[model samples]
Target: MLRDHLQRYDPVFQHAAIGMALISLQGSFIQVNPVLCELLGYSQQQPDSISQLDHAYQDVLSAVTEFGGSLQSQPLPQGTFELQIQQTAGRQLTVTIHLTLIYDEQVPQYYLAQFENRSLLTETKTQLLSTETMLRDIQDSYQQLLEKMPLAVLITRNGVIQYVNPAALQLVHARDQSEAIGISTDEIVDSSYHYSLSERRKTYYEHQTPLQSITYLINCMDGQQKLVEGFTLLINYDGGPAAVGVFKDITEQREKEEFMMQSEKLTMAGQLAAGIAHEIRNPLTSINGFMKLMRSSDRSSEAYFDIMESELKRIELIVNELLVLSKPQSKHKSQAVDILPVIDQVVTLMDVQATLKNIEILCDKPDSPVQIVGEVNQLKQVFINLLKNGMDAMASSGSIHVMITTNEHEVLISVKDEGSGMTAEQIQQLGQPFYTTKETGTGLGYMITQNIIHNHGGSIQIDSVPDRGTTFTVKLPKLVSVEASSN
Candidate 1:
């Protein structure tokens, strides 16, 4: 029966796909399959000449002897291990070997071994581990950069906040990231802008588009409102799409702008008051003379009273114009203002200044009322800036022509000064902040004027020649009708 069993096992072991071998307890090969010979690059006749198995034999022997003297009393033990082996040509190959002990009549006989080449599998796993480590390093570096950025940054997905950087937390006065994360974007943005923000987010997600720089009023945790200018774009995060917003706090910038505007307004008022001082005094002198004549005479004449009243009204108009220009303005109030009256008032206020400089201001009023929807005070300031710029450009006595013309869609008011004209380069730099041709000019006036015109949905253009003069043409959208303006 043992002979028959050996005959059955020999064919199966010899024809096995994997390398197979049978070794004696003394570590000498009892049988070696053709597959084992090929795997070690050895001839079938040299089964005992496997020098590469020398080191592996020691380990196998040690493992088998661990069961020691009780091997026969206990169940037969099997062991497996991995090692690098040398082929016939000295090439190194990694392999896994499985060892099992065979028992004959309940006595240890030989060891059965199976070998599997793991060189390619080992190389592949090593490459995968290296790639994973590199990716982890890159992610760590990116996270560090985001943490240190000064600009406020946040990430959101499906309109829910996912991340907030330190700057973002400070901007909204949040205690920590936990206070902001998981909150809806609508909760952070002002309620007035919720609809617009929702629509913008919807459009971006639907089309995978990026949002342009826009100003937002953020409702802070501390019940403070902050203005931030930011842009949003879609980014891949954790294998999914998310929106990353980069923002700059513009609240201080806007406040500074308002403060500058107010400063310019005061400066202009001071200049206007100085220029009209004599005009105010002339009327006051006339009224004083009339009062003296009435006090000395027995009775006051109706014509004298009329003259006094007219002089007083003149002083009052001048004072009122000065007050309007110098007063603190309500930044948000706007109405349909007739352009003609605004120009007339500006001309009247500036006329005395022009007269002092020996410059005549000629205003050509339109027959029909040309009206525009804007803040009246801002419009007054716009004209004041233009007229002052015109006056400053002149060296000597010259006329400043103010012309009002209209097209089907817009109204054009041109202030042409017979002063030192500018070059094309100077004209190009007209609206830039802190760029001025005058020795005493702040250069904020034109910039503020340009901002106000743009806010009113209008534009200003300049035409100049070196020796001739400069013309500032302001184009404003014409109000369609009284009813339309009211609506």
Candidate 2:
């Protein structure tokens, strides 16, 4: 009776778009529509039924068999699944397969299977995945550009920072962007510039200036102070007025300008001193010759002539030191000069003075000569001046220790004095022209010494403690030798 009823609808099922098939419990095809044959690339001699031996529909048959087994123990409603079917032309199609069991008085009779194509759904899903990938790439590119920007970028509302890029976090010495977010912008700004910056921010919000530029001092989390040139834009953020600032550090630039100005002033002062020294030295030389003749002519005035001669010699000494200070530094004759021999020569020259003051001179040097490319005479002058100062600092007796050490890139020469040390205030005043600690000392010595070291691309550091002693460490780059490459 069921077969007769199904046969009555054969005309409707034969021409339907969905593929349909009828199969018996023994897995043999009872009947198949033209649509089913076309979908499987079958001829009029289509396969009898679902078969596990066929590769194209093996996956579908396995699922159908499992469904059919479940129908044996209990009645089941229609069920659906999806599978990819390959035709003889090597083309593939995704189809949804629906299965229903036809029972004859509680005994399994046949399975009615239907397949609906799902090719359009697969195409839409593929397009969606490609679009998502493109969007993610665009977002990553935007994030990379922001991180690589040279200037620091900050976005704020009501003085509270809302966003800070990596550059901004680095500018403020923040560990990361999270540390800078939600913090008050005023906290990082230097106190002196707080009111001014705040006022500018207010002006932008009140009138919507759109753009403004200013320079201010900013204090970093690491305790460093910087002068930053900021360009700010007034923008709408989250439906309210906001300020976006881009800052470039200008501290080093400003310092360079000031140094150039100071250099000009020093040049002028040197020219004036040179002229005055020349004018005084000529007259003083003639007076000294006349005093010498008078001392030789009569013993009665000899003692008085001696006193005058000593004062004249002191004046000459001051004039010579002044000339040295006014002289311009030259690097043309620099060579790989051994620092050990130079230090030894300076020690020999000052050894007599040290002995007279009951002081000992000790030297520690490596066996190999420590070499640097610099003016040999200037290096000698530096060691001599520093050693003399150490001798002068010790009133009665003490030892002067000079040590030389070397590393891969540089050489370190340290001069230590066991004498009355200097206070912090006194140390700060060092290297200034016309500033000295000793009554008879001329402050130009240290200033000239530092100038020579700086010209050689070296640096000097002094460590002193009150009532103890002082140590001056000089660091100079070592001369590196290049080995010839083998041909």
Mind giving the per-residue lDDT tens digits that candidate 2 earns over 1-487? 7668577659867678888877656555556677887777776454543342244565566677677667666646467778887776787888888888877777677888887878778878889999989977976896687679888999898889988888898888899878888988788888998889778867776776766688989989999999999888777665787888899999999999899999988885885477446545654776677677776875446665676676577677667877897688764488889999999999999999899999999999999877799988899999999999999999988899999999888899999998899989999988755568987766778988998999898999999997789999999999876541232
Any runs in candidate 2 off by more than 4 Å, and if so which? 1-260, 263-304, 483-487
Clashing pairs in 1: none
Winning model by TM-score: 1
lDDT (Cα) of model 2: 0.81
The residue ranges of model 1 lying beyond 4 angstroms of the native Cα positions read 1-17, 30-77, 84-94, 103-108, 119-131, 236-239, 265-487
* Candidate 2: residue 168 Cα off by (Å): 21
lDDT string for model 1 (1-487, tens) is 5456467679878779998877667665656678877887777776455554554456644544443323445565576678777776787788887877777787777777788889889888999999999999998997888899999999999889999989999999999999999999899999988887988887886877778877899999999999999998789887889989999999999999999999997886676566577567877999999999999999879999999998888777656655544344446577888999989999999999999999999999788889888988789889998999999999999899999999878999999998889998888877544457987554557766777788788999899998799999999998899586588
